[model samples]
Target: MPSSVPPFSELLANTRESAVHFEMRDDYGTNPRLEAWQRGERINWDDRESWWHPFHQTIADAVARGVAVRRARIVSEPVSEYIRWEHYATHANVMAGEDVRWLPRSQATGFLVPANDFWLFDGKLIRVHHFAGDGRHVSDELSTDPGDLKLCVSAFEEVWQRAIPHSEYTI
Candidate 1:
């Protein structure tokens, strides 16, 4: 159970190590590990081409460590492009036994805010809405309430149900 007043980092530390979840159109973070999937060694942050950052690595690492990961997305051309070339399939094989769910983008409907990002983990929820031209400062929505978190989880599950199993997913 997370407290309502503490900053997100505190709540994150108290939760189980593998409980983090995110709803993003592209990846997040500035670590070197992200370079592996992106086309070039350097990422173009502001563009869609750079979307393959830490998100893929994080999920891949989580799966390798035996944490369950579920994903729902609009299945943009980029995701399929990576899948087609077997970029992720290779790492995906290491955690072959665990389940990885993929839901179509259309299924994400209302949840996909063109300029906002969503994250849900344990009982915490964080929503980041981008403002400005280069995505400088962003607005956030944070809550530890079960009801709010459930909405995000439910959205994840709805797409999960309609998604193909990892084994069958293809580019």
Candidate 2:
């Protein structure tokens, strides 16, 4: 852990080559969007403007600057409500020029992977996110430790290799 862990936007802005995110959770507690989706609310897919938020904007900007942004998720199925919502909304990520992929938990058997979610920046530094069992965020760390970096980078690449592209994944 470093003394100063920059915010996600700052990390993204500073990344020169690639940014990869590894998400292994099926739920993230609940947000307004998750709650809405849980109540059967759905995005009006035709109206793309309504869903464009700052995160997607930042990702788009990073892509424009030549940073390759990719996200990989290892989820349990038949998916949780949060994952279902994530799948439904992933088109926004695609539109933002991010490559999104999903790997079922069963598909990743026997692989050594991180316990926390993380964003690996330029393959050197990582920002790891900690969450509680019910899926509420707890804390995060920015690390450059050699062992941590090796595991994060390798695990992510393995997951990315086995993951199904967002466009092709079903449920």
Candidate 3:
């Protein structure tokens, strides 16, 4: 984590062409919504005013500016409850103009996947998310190294190609 690294919003705002995210975890235990869902507090997907958040607005703004925003998740088969909740809530992301996809871990056999989740902006910079054993976000590592950038772009594209679109994927 660099002391001068820009915030994620700044990275997204500066991105000109694309912002692709790769999520490789099955359970993001730190998500508050996951806990809420577990306790039977469901999100009213029909009410955009209630469900939409700042991140969704950011994606919408990026898309409005002609940036192609895509998010691909690689999860284990027989997905966890958290994944199912994500799958359900992903409609909000789509509504916000993001292309979301899901790929089973078994399907990613030979691909060179990165160890951590990352957002590759315009195929140039990467913000890799570091997480603890219990799936809590620890910190983010930013890199613009050519090699790292190449790896993130290649890995995301490969995963995107093999992943099923959100509308078609089922947990």
Candidate 4:
């Protein structure tokens, strides 16, 4: 790990070619929205004015600057509540100009999936996220190691190839 890992926004802002994210978790613990969703609350996808937060704005800006942003998720079947919410909320990501996909865990058998979630920037740098057993975010680990980068790129590409695009995936 480096002494200093730039913030995600900075990394995305600096990206010139592409930014790819791989999420392999069924639930992200401690999220209030997930809790709300678990209680049967629905997200207002049409309320973009209020829902387009800074993160989405950053992604939108990056796309405007020609950075191809894509996200792929490897999820369990009969998806968890968190995943269901994620699926419901994916329209926002699509509207932000991100390409998103979902692949059931059963279909990811042969790929060398990384243990942690990560954002790979421009095929060179990777910001890997660590989480506690309870799904609380721990810290991010950044790396530019060739082996790590290669694994992330290969694994993500494979998952992306096998995943169903967001428009077609159903929870």
Candidate 5:
């Protein structure tokens, strides 16, 4: 059997005209993979590893190529800890020179949905989905409608305008 998969790539390609999107809730804190990674434990990189994905190459490609990547996070205390444990400690390994835009939930446009939550990326908005709680599962789904992406783009703009710069927030 193949080590990697194709459906995720196909989905991302479908949304190339717009941004990729996802959402999560406090339940994400209970994820085991996340707990281990947060504690600086080693994580296997093989296919059988918990929530593994073969898609980091693509996300890195988008960032390195200077495509505008925007993210609206519902910042909680645990998520904040995860960000520090993951991103700040490995900044050199995570991203090089490209600007990363992260925003607070209130600044973002859409309200948190009752289920998996609402997301519009590259002109598509999806309300219910799941996340692995670690950096392993690449759940980026593509949008079929350009108008959906446009709406997301507009939402990102509204958040981007009111959010603090990463430079200011990163300490």
Candidate 6:
């Protein structure tokens, strides 16, 4: 939410038609929330009030507005612990109305994917996520280049097609 890039909710607010998130990473280290989940804390999943957070609110709002909110992650098989945590955490994302999918990296051989993670909104612009080699956050950037937009949309669609829905993917 820093720099010139807009906050994600605002971007989602402005979107129409679609908001596709394409992620390509194996390990993202750890966070306090993740550690808590790993330490045996669990969401009731049925209690909407207990886990419906602002991020989920944004996605739900978009879906209510008819914007197709989708998320696709390309990950390595025999996934990292972080990814294992993410797989569980994704239940919230799914409940919020995102059509989430997962694709193993080994099966992504013939497709093209961007070098970084990005959220392409309405296929007009993208907010790219940059990370350190060890998988720490660095910064975010916004891009509106036609070529970049095309690549992001194409890459996302290809991976999304090959990905398994969250309910179907196994660890």
| Candidate lDDT (C-alpha), each | 0.47, 0.92, 0.89, 0.90, 0.45, 0.92
Model number with the top TM-score: 6
Residues 3-74 of candidate 2 have per-residue lDDT tens digits of: 467778999999999999999999889898878877887888688788889999999999999999999999
Q: Which parts of model 6 are misplaced by more than 4 Å?
A: none
For candidate 5, list the clashing residue pairs, or say none.
18-122, 19-122, 122-149, 123-148, 123-149, 124-148, 124-149
Clashing pairs in 1: 73-105, 74-105
- By lDDT, the better pick of 3 and 5 is 3
TM-score of each: 0.48, 0.94, 0.94, 0.94, 0.51, 0.96
List of clashing residue pairs for candidate 3: none
TM-score of 3: 0.94
Clashing pairs for predicted structure model 4, backbone only: none
Taking all chains together, the TM-score of candidate 6 against the true structure is: 0.96
lDDT: the better of candidates 2 and 5? 2
How many clashes does each candidate structure show, in the order listed?
2, 0, 0, 0, 7, 0
User: How far off is residue 18 in model 4, in Å?
Assistant: 0.3
For model 4, how does the per-residue alpha-carbon lDDT over 1-171 read when each residue is reduced to its tens digit? 443778889999899999999999887786776677778887777677867879899999999999999999999999987788889878888999999999999999976987899999999999999988888888898999999999999999999999999999987
C-alpha lDDT of residue 96 in model 6: 90
**Residue 166 miss distance in model 3 (angstroms):** 0.2
Off by over 4 Å in 2: 1-4
- lDDT of candidate 6 over 83-107, digit per residue (tens): 9899999999998999999999999
Residue 120 displacement (Å), model 1: 1.8
